[model samples]
Target: MPKVSRIIPILENLLFFWLGLALVLSLAGDSLNIPSLLQVLGRAHPLILHFPIVLLLMAVAMLWIKDEKIKEIGTWVLLLGANLTGLTVLAGLLLANEDYDGAMLFWHQWLGVASLGLSVLIYFYRDKSSSFLKISTGALAVAIVLTGHFGADLTHGENFLLTPIQSNEEEFVALDDAEVFQHMVKPILEAKCISCHKEGKVKGELRMDDLAGLQKGGKNGPFVVPGDLKESLLIQRIHLPEDSKEHMPPKNKAQLTDEELEILQLWVESGSSFEQKVTELESEEPLFQLASNKFSNQKSYTFDAASDSDISELNNFFRKVNPVFPGSPALEVAYYGTSAFDPTSLKDLKSIKEQVVKMNLNRMPLESVDLSFLRDFQNLEELQMNFTGVTPNQLSNLEGLENLRNLAISGNSLGAEAVSVLEKLTQVKKIFLWNSGLDESSKENLRKALTTAHIDFGFDGKGIIYALNPPKITFDKELFQDSMELVLSHPIRTAEIRYTLDGTEPDSISSPVYTAPIWLKKTAQIRAKAFAADWTGSLTVSDLLFKSGIQPESYRLAFEPNTKYKAKGAASLFDGIKGKTGHGSGNWLGFKDTSMELEIFIAENTSPNEISISLLLNEIAYIFPPENVEIWTGNQQGWQKLPNTDNAQSTKIEEVRFGMLTFPLPETDFDKVKIRLRPISKLPAWHPGAGAKGWVFVDEILLN
Candidate 1:
């Protein structure tokens, strides 16, 4: 034991010496490649760190043990602990050489090394050196705690453990009024970057805790060169590929999304101003509206005061009256839940006449006579009376509402003369009129009457409204051998079709204009959406087409398909059209509560290496993968199961995913091939709708 004790001190001195050398090497290690062995050992720093923590704490506990034998045992344990602490510190040093925030690494690293050195010293002089032991023990305890704290912060986030309790609710800011830098951009930086780039934790000497520090830059210099994202190092680092070693937030850390990156880029392009408001950007600009929606805060009004009792009294089952926001004095009165709304409900709201500033009487069964009560709501800024039986004369009642900024009466039986009355309200900014009985010429005249107000003809309506309808993707045939041509058409001839070939939904600006027939050569998903300059964009319609490049002359199904989902004879299986995800799309062949057996005959005797079958899985709809699939070959024994391939079956139950499952076949020449698909008898307990019948949805089965 004495010899072991003497050898431990020698080992401790060697570790202390190596630590000093490592500290010097780490200064330049960020750019240089270390030995692969050291790098491999460094990867274990996270798992190895806890050992020293437990040992050091146990050593501290040993100090309080009154027995002499226990004290001797404690000394031996301390010696073993000193060796472990040194090894942990060495591993940590190797880890520190890799990419990590330097400021965050500094204190934890040095303190850990110091604690190990103290442990070694205390182990040697526990009996003979009382004063040294007493001083070093307290210092070691503090050093270990602080080192662990910073280490925890490095692994998680700064104050991660404390965040749950320390977090306090912050005040909300409206998107239009919010400062671009303070509310939108800075918060993103603080959450994602500031932990590594803040004051004490400034990795690369870049402090992002304050605007001034960001302006001053770090070791590489200015983070932003105002209006030049290309020149800005901050933007450059953020835009780096997430897999890249130089990427901001580093590997495995939470990353900034495309939207957040766009917002950052927009702020930089707008001169990186701290005080710029979202309202300053025009509503027509894409980023302006995008940022406006992003920063929108839904909170109670903070203005003086609406009577809650009065507002409550004005509300009923069909009609509701409340503050525009939580604490605002301005009230919003709306009617809902009734298919046939009674216009007389407007009379009850007269009690909160001074408070009401927005009234939504959408789908109300109102006429010219019912609108007479609206003149009392002089403070009303927004009025929605869409789908009402209102006429031209009824609009005159709203002329008294000078504060009205938005007036929506789109689905009424009003003429252009009704919109002309809006000219009297000088403050009106927008007027909706798609379904009103106004002609094109009358609409032009109405636009001239209200020159300041934007005439909205329900141009952006999404749901089942009368003005705009979704586009249909028409094709000669969904399945084709070599290629398929797609045509996009809408009910309204004037609508333009915009499409994306990458399976993502088409947007107005980003999607390509579909002028000609889109030809597909390989398996591709085409998504097309319709839009008009003066009408709302349509919902996307998607179609997946397959190009197997091979043809089968004949095929047979062992069992008949359900009457509701039968394909056109046996040729449907060989057809190169891929089915969509849903069951109702009619592209799928669903076999409910039954297994599938199929045999295909080709004109030529070709020995194909593999065959792939397209299958759909939507557990909610009880569509599941086949329990087992078997392939048979025509040999001397007539038919036999093919040799099992290397592909392993997945035991995991996942969400809806349409996939092409490939099965390897034996190299044998046969004109005919048979496939047997076995479906699950019942849904698993993990499924939401458990104990239900399992279905197998198969589309195109292609031999390659």
Candidate 2:
């Protein structure tokens, strides 16, 4: 008998032929009623199609068998695959012939017929070892595949094969804008916000990433008062133009999402003062039962559990509260425990198994815990089995933990096998393992395995020791003064990282710091820590922010030229094209006077820092880029650049950050000059092609 695979290649060849014919039919505008005909045969095209697919797939599997000598037996199996596949192709061709179509189905018909022909040709060569025969067979095989794929696409959408990826992406645990802020939003803000807004050295004077943070809007004044979104200075800054000086996120930082904004709004309007969140959810029953107290309705919850405690605690929790699920009790429960882990107990908990929304077995030994009990906990939202004896094998019973959102397996003997059980529970986002025996590779692999949810592991009992960020020294902007504001912020939840500016660790006696945003400034050091008992210390970024002193008046007292130079005027040091780059020293174009209408180029000599100049075009109208313009002197030395997307129009000024340009006049110091230049968009020279067009042309003379 021919080996299974020997038959498979032949069958697969026939299958591809059919597949190709299908594609050509669809493409050629065939109104193929083949599917309808197959349906009439009681084996629709969808059904008839499966046989060829299975046979071809079986043929490939037969080929993959490694035992060559014994594989001969499998070779015959391939022949069977081929025969079945041929049957499939015949049926498919018969069905295709039923479709009558216009030009649209013309190619579809040909593609199918051609595929069938190619499959027949390939089948004839399956037994031949001749290279030419093999090559010819291979070419036919490729065409067959291309035909099949296009056929499927015609039946399905362009992403039919990749629908899983899109579905997975779309199915992440969705948190609304409000809930999003509670989790994702608050974490980012508390991590990066708060500084430069708390106290005296306040830059914008806005301190809250919290309710208070919102209430105390920064320099622009109270961002959000009670119930006032429009009046909120905080929201105002968020809405500022990205390049506007009032932009709130400061420089190089991610912005808050609208969802986070909504959370802030809701909390503010209601005077949100809740600090601890998880604990609040713990007692949500009170709010759930407060209004539904129709005492006459005596409700009972029935669950299946091996243990009574699982039901006992649940009953106690729901003792005073009966959740109304539609018309019945809203709560459902289930439990699974064995005599080893208390099998009788697991069984008893099963009585009210449907109402078991939350089950706390923290630190309880589940060595023999009925692993399959998870199937009963369909309503289980929060399962605390931390410190339980869970291993890799028994964890598979948790495949039914689809509703399990929070699972703490900290300090368990759980290993790779246990984490594998997690793939089925895509909804489970957070599985905490503090001091768990999880290795780095397993954790990373689990991360890849669970794309929808985040997994976290922390050292046991070793909570994060806080590290306080240094205060912003806001004196004369960029210059540190004795009165600069020092700032420190910490995680709003639980933390305290030791920090210091005197280059020392902050001790409790060293002025215990609160987690709130603090403001102060000096050469003095600062730091923080978790101070809680048995907490893991956090790393600190020492000297995070050095207080800035007041910068002195930096404008050089020199004569600058004006525009509209008499093109014939002799040129001076300040009256010609200038270009510069680098950090060595002050390279300037000295102008004895701006009287001469000569053009001078005063450029930045490649300094990484801002290189700006006040172009005095008192003589005539001067042209330069608009976006990069800056004010002369004071704290207005900030540089701005236009987005590269905007091309420099004929009227647009050419601003280059890679270098600079200046044409100071020595012939005439004109009256009223527009300081029409700021530093260019300073991106790295090696950065991807962007912000590159930095040439500024000034004609060296213009008319006002």
Candidate 3:
């Protein structure tokens, strides 16, 4: 009781001081130059405000307790709540000195002060009648709730609470009909830039919620200058280093994606017109391709959905019958595994012919199968028979497909006879007859006959030299106990696979031609490329094969991975499942601005010679290799530090790639191994996110 008496007086004095400070700060408003220390303390308002909300709500609930001992405890709770409420209101007042405005902020500030004042009143009148205390506490609770609601609106944008129930359904706009600004540029801004620059919390006096405000600009100039990217404020900010104060979005906010940035640049370059339709731009322009990709051309189908049981029954290992998209009635049937394909597989889809809008028989053995089964699919819009052994006679079966808009018969041995059958299909807008034994003269005749349809005789390999795709490299295992077989093959059978054993680029003349799988006895870096007689040499593709001397029994991570890219948890590192290039593929363990520390437990009598960590680098996405890596081997008694490796910081943006960091370990027996990976503390000055922490992504860790 004596301790409570002393604390209450001190708390009351502190509460009075906070109340006065808050009033002064609130009155000072935007005119006040908040100190650096005060700004840091103000930012902690979000963290501290929650405590008072929970405590004050609990204190209000306690007013109903009839027990004398509980009532005595309620007094202490009310005093603590009042003191905290004053502090919270003061913090909020200081935070409001930032670029916060609008009705939401206005209401949140007043209501927070009202709640604090009411809490103090409730504390002072604790000895009053139960009814009076209950009434006062109830009003204070209502004020707190309102204050929190508006505060949320200020921080998370308007209607944050109602967002879950709100419909986010996007209207499907056709590619040709989509407006350049409304359909493309507006959406990008809404997703990446609008949250911070919206009405209530305009970061730089720039309101991006509407077009007029964008034209008005912020403290700078206009947001965009049509046909002048150099003068455009939006482009300038977007191109600025991510850590720059003038950047469109702060480093902490979601940045503009590569595609989005490209689109904006193209839009400005093409004269940023708000009313320009996608078709207004030249068809060959890059903006048109981007717009075509951004907007869906799919028309709503009127056909009834196929029965689930029928779809399920039709789907097999070789044949797949599924909707083109979720909740779509239109079905797309694809045939895979040429050996398992049967003529009956095509006939089996008769039950749902009306719903089958697209059919892909690419590379299937269609010589024996009757393609006449396709005539039954009256609603079919696209039919692909690429390299499917389709004959000129088989092409006649597609004549009656009135709804067919796209027809692909690439790699077929079709002649002039097939052109006649195609000319009859008047509804077909696009016809792909690439490598379909139709001579240039016949293709020209077909193009003349079908004036409305586009006859694409793809890539006449005459004078133009095309580069061969990189050879596909595969290994039996990346982390092997003794040796691993590395196989290299190219898609074009005529192309020769050239590779290098060392970490040098493979050349057509000097590199060894790959025939049989190469057996790698130790850790090696393989670089391979495809080379053909006429085609240009392909870009080099590389992979690191690690030789493991010891396999760890178990492993543990010091920190949990980022929630967005946790993959399969800590087990993912040793699971031998290498993540693809993209981080969103759910294979890589992503850490943002944090070091990765892993401990591996080795079995008895296994002394590993090396440790290899595979890392992903996508500089444009801000994912970089580790700045430095440290390795430690130890038992229960002590630990020994191994020679560490440091990575040179990248200066230019590169394509998404994978790199291996190998650490040579001393030949000493140890039961445990600890690896520490420190990500780049700050991105390079040449990079967009200069001065911001880079990301480190890892999928596999090998102990050799």
The best candidate in terms of lDDT: 3
Q: Give me the displacement of residue 376 in model 2, in angstroms.
A: 1.7
Q: Indicate the residue-level lDDT of 205 in model 3.
A: 83
Better of 1 and 3 by TM-score: 3
- Could you tell me the lDDT of residue 576 within candidate 2? 31
Residue-level lDDT of model 3, residues 494-550, one tens digit each, is 999989875689888988999899999877779999989888999898887766545
Which candidate number would show the highest TM-score if scored against the true structure?
A: 3
Candidate numbers sorted by lDDT from highest down: 3, 1, 2
Residues 1-704 of candidate 1: C-alpha lDDT, one tens digit per residue: 79886886687576566556555644655666779998888888888888878877788668546687877777767766777777788788777765465466788777887787678677767776656666777788899999988887876667766888985787567763577788888889988888777644567778787778888887876788798765677776774433446668785677776567767777777788777666566675656767767765443343456676777677778887887676668888889965746656668777777778888878777764557788887777789988877787777787777778788888787775765675676677777877788777887777787777677765544554443566788776655667777778777788888888756788889789988888776556678888887566776767655558456667789986655456654566766666654454566776765668898775666666667777776554456778777888664447767875443332444434575566667776666679877777776776533565567778888776
Tell me how candidate 3 scores on lDDT.
0.81
Candidate 3 worst ten-residue window by lDDT:
239-248
Cα TM-score of candidate 2? 0.28
For every candidate, C-alpha RMSD to the true structure in Å: 15.2, 25.5, 11.7
Instruction: Give the alpha-carbon lDDT of every model.
Output: 0.71, 0.43, 0.81
- The alpha-carbon lDDT assigned to residue 406 of candidate 2 equals 75
Residue pairs with clashing backbones, model 1: 300-326, 300-327, 301-325, 301-326, 301-327, 301-328, 459-536
What is the alpha-carbon lDDT for the whole of candidate 1?
Answer: 0.71
Assess candidate 3 and give its TM-score to the true structure: 0.51
